[model samples]
Target chain A: MYSRDEFFLLIEDLSLLPAISPSCRSAFDKMEDPEASLIGIGHLIEEDPGLASRLIKVANSPFYPYSGKVGSVREALVRLGLETTRGVILTTSLFDRIRGEAGVYALWQHSLAVSMISRNIAGHLRMPYPDEVALAGLLHDIGKIPYFMHDASEMHRSISDVDPGRPDYKREKEAFGMDHMEIGEHLTISWRFPSIVCAPIRWHHNPAKSPEADRTVVRIVALGDLIASAYGLGHPEFPFVDGDILQLTEELNLLGAEVTSLLTDFLYDRDLIVQRSHDVF
Target chain B: MARMMKVELATTEDGEMIVQDVHDMLGRLLVRAPRRIDPELKRMLLARGIQEVFIPDQSSGDAEYERQIVEQERDAIRKRFSRLQDTPDNKRIVEIFIRAFEVFHAEKGKIPPV
Candidate 1:
């Protein structure tokens, strides 16, 4: 029923897997604890020289303006907190692999918009793990990559805001036999991502009424999407969630001020997202 | 736990819960199907630890969605996943998904196979 060529874009190249990122490697080596951090994460990253270089690149980025030019991976770690450093490495590595249309840069902007809005929403609500919410929000639609199936960047813009729940993803499944969410979830699992990220991915698109009404994490991602839609930065294929927001607000017993506050942060961070897409990506 | 009827993937609602449960149970194994669960959407869900080939259920549709659209897309997704089963990576991937549901939710309630 649909004519689509899937590129498995989101599916991580199992072979190209770099162990981890540089800062993660250095910090993991210094770590006494395993669960909170790991040595393998850093060592794996150190394996990729490219990751090492990117850490320096990220540290130099205006996000972390170091007074003195402290040059070294360990110094880079100190300047960018260990976790943020790790995020930088991972983000860079992931970005290095993505190839798409000229508009992909714009798509990156949308992702960052969602990511920024998600963090703002989480913070306004005093939700824990703000960074995670931001990361997930930014990469939420990462699945769409392979949906374009390594084709021209034009393919992405070409996709109308068709009901992704309808024909676009359905057709994508027809072409590749798996949707981007499935691909992304598998990639994360394969990469050994924590469940906090994985669970939302599964439920992000379709939140469970009963469990969502109760669980904080579910509410977080679901809410993140809502805030992102409200921000007016577009992930077109994403559900145009307006009317549902009011109903969801009532159902979640949320106040209107809570929503307004988040939108404010979103606008605040809009520059970071725009800059990151152009500079970082 | 007794795994429930291998969670059905007929509807988007079914798809969400089924995918969530499978993902929760899978641990390191990735079991997410990005395709939103809805009647007639082409989807493969491992729910309640059972991997079921879903053809959207018309009986479940109310005012918004019905069988006409659901069935066509399903056939498309079916073909998609079937092709994956033939690949080396996906072959192992699917097995890992099934094993995860089996081991994790064996006591919850098993969902029968398709």
Candidate 2:
């Protein structure tokens, strides 16, 4: 059994590790400023030419809804909005950190799929902050990254043995002495992300247990995770849909017909979405 | 001219015709008939995680007809769920799916008809 202090130390070690580049970090920090203009945010991104170029690529990529190509960082920022821009920046940075690791790319692909699906579900339901939920979906499994960094093979083995029919959280806890949700929540909290985002990361596997106020968003992310898994987008270890998915959908007031249509849409779009994920990541 | 093709059962909607016996992943025969597909069968297929089944392919001369059928099904499904669309939560989900679909089409060309 791992002590709580061990988990805290893991977080501390992760904090000390070289994760995001300084320029990306600065760009993220600047995004928090209400007074920060698009140009200012653009310039901060420009400091890291690679990130700027990738941001433009993503902005023009099939992910964003816009038609025309975004030619510059400023245009990308204006098109993507602050929250999605932050998500893009963080995703790119995190991808850089774990680019070549076995299974990491696949995990990122899964995360991106979940992010897109979460945003879709939230927007369809007219949630107040869909992008925040998207961000949560993107980072929900982030706690696994530290474990991969520590021992990729061990982490891979642990997840590979998980029973597909059950939620992987308990297995994760048993294997690593801390589940990904706990580690993810702690990390996101330390990153200063709002509770709206952090709570979903912590409770996405079991949305009914989340605080009543945050339940909707948490359920959306949870559904997104399930859909992404169902579509075979990312990590294969936890591919089975949780039995509670239908119940959660009902609680969120999504109609059976809506769920059917959504599943149809996903079925038709799965290959292309998987392809887009590979291209983006 | 029509031929038979193995397709994922989950992708088959109600009214489609199955051409052979459907079996679960464990090889247990679930449905044995050249039967017209229905919602209950689809649900049972999905429940067992059965990935593929043989189906009659009438997509030859009636490609337009097939497309129309798919569109109608999609439309009916949408209308049924339309009441939820006005809410912020459902709206965001629809917007995201549309955006993702648009992007996929733009980047990879149109997805071929299933």
Candidate 3:
């Protein structure tokens, strides 16, 4: 097993780790702005012309409800509001900016699927801040990005052998001394996201033992991950324990049927997002 | 001698102003108001089954402080980039932030604190 410090250090060493470009730093600081966060993010998207194009594409897609086709960032912001737009833009930017071409396509689809599922489940359960839950889902597997960046072919090998009923990801976590969720959490915190979000990304895998785990949000991502991982849709090759989910659902006051329905939508959206992954910078 | 802190409540609909100096009587934190006394709001709260509603802005009829963050941002950005002769993306990132700040300023009609 890799030592804990070593596993965490691998995350710290990511190439993009130190470059807190002024824009990103400012975004983190502006997170406290209660009134115009969406507008601010819309402004950010407009700056990255390519991201603006993709966001418009997704907003206009049939998956979301629109009075008509969304033709501009302002229209999209008006439709999604500040919280939801910020969530969507941040997720899209990370996928666009942080990964390499080789293995990123699949994970992008997976993260979106997880996000859709997590949001749907949160709404069904009457959980607070469904959009925030979706943001957590988008970020939950973020650790895998750096890991894939560090070594692509190795992750591909592991993907070929994943199974959840047995919990083999435990071994890999011990081997590397950390798992994807931990790595993702570190980056999210470094980016200055709220603790509500950073917690779920860290604990979605091992909710019971995770230091900052939020039962509802973590459960949403964990269950969504299971479906994605199982179907090989943005699928990672990692196994999760089944009973852990049952315990979490009970703790979070959610039902299996809600999760299953969300998973169906997630899988559907995953197809479209994956096909269009090339639209961003 | 304990200093009395006067607490008052006002809303668009109805209001209560308690003027007595509540020196030792005032609670350190907000306590739940008695349910039976607030029959109307209590009934609404029960139907929603959500106990708490978060109100973002808390204002008293106290002295209002004008917000002052946006005024210096453009200047800050210009000055920050002036020293970045060594790096380019650093310049780009700063530019992005300033643009974002502009959006915030435009929307809120004021700039945020630097």
Candidate 4:
């Protein structure tokens, strides 16, 4: 059993740990500038031809769903908005980093589903920052990526052994001395993500325990995660819905009929979601 | 003009031909068509927690009736939940779900059901 400190050391030593690409980092920084023009951000992204091409690909993917093809990074940035564009670049870079690792595809698929669901939930709730919430959903399970990088077999075993009735984090803690949420929280903080985004990644499995300011979005994300799990979107080892999820739904005042409709819609959309995930990953 | 109906997978017997291929939520093909479902396949579907499969009703393919069913369900949902105070949050959430569903339906329509 690895101690928490030892696990941190292991993460440090792992070559496959997620690092923002220099070009992406530069592009993100440029976008952050209050006076940065769309053209300026586009130029920075174009500096990395590979990232530029991927941005265009993702922009054209179902997630964006433009009537016509996105011809350049500028078009993608304009259409997807700065935050979502940054998320696409970051997500693609992260996927590239862990592409061949066992279970990466499954994880990516799960993340995409969660992200889509989160955005939907946020949209439903009329939240001001739906894109940010969506981005948070995409990165929620990212902590597990390092484990896959270090020990693919053990990670696969853990996922396979996941019992839906119990929190998967507890099992992870017992095995590795820390859960993916904790690792993800740390990683997001290092990446300088806002507290709103980091909070959901950390507290999604247990929204009631989140900080008061962050609870609403956390609850939204938690519900989204449960919805994705219930639909068996990605890896199936995790539980779909539990007591906490039920309680959260009630607290949110989501009606049973609404939930049923949501499920029906999910069923209807499952195929397209899967196809989009493959395209992104 | 497709009407949705639920088909129980548990009650399906061996040698019963599957009219359409069944897929899981992730869109992975669970059972292929042109073949009869056997005990093993049934067990596999059950183990995956798939209790039922929803398919288009072949007998009455009335598109308008299907649309009415959907509208009625939406109306019932609205009425049942209407007692709760209306808030921008709730309205937005419902709208988002609706939009998401529309996108899904449009995209799904473009491809043949597997």
Best by lDDT: 2
Ordered by lDDT, highest first, the candidates read 2, 4, 3, 1
Question: Model 4, which residues run further than 4 Å from truth?
Answer: A12-20, A32-36, A65-68, A162-166, B1-114
lDDT of 1 by residue, B1-114 (tens): 322222223223534333232332224333453344554332222211122333333343332232333333333223223422255644443333233323322222333222
| Deviating ranges (above 4 Å) for candidate 2 | A1-4, A162-166, B1-114
Rank list by DockQ: 4, 2, 1, 3
Say what the RMSD of model 4 is: 8.3
Please provide, for model 1 over A154-241, each residue's C-alpha lDDT reduced to its tens digit, 9 standing for 90 to 100.
3443343234345334544655566656666666555455566655555565555324332555556666665554333444343233
lDDT of 2 by residue, A36-79 (tens): 88888888889888889888888887656578888999998888
| Candidate 2, B1-114: lDDT as tens digits | 357666555446788888889764235688886888887676555434344577776565545544544444344323323434255665444444444344433344344523
- Writing each residue's lDDT as its tens digit, candidate 4 over B2-77 gives 4455555544447766667776545678777655777766655644435455544554445554454344334433
Identify the superior model by lDDT, candidate 1 or candidate 2: 2
* DockQ in order: 0.01, 0.04, 0.01, 0.07
lDDT of 4 at A60: 90
Give me the candidate number with maximum DockQ. Answer: 4
Q: What does candidate 3 score on TM?
A: 0.56
Each prediction's Cα lDDT score? 0.48, 0.68, 0.53, 0.67
Docking class of 3: incorrect
Give me the displacement of residue A13 in model 2, in angstroms.
3.5
Cα shift from native, residue A269, model 3 (Å): 4.7
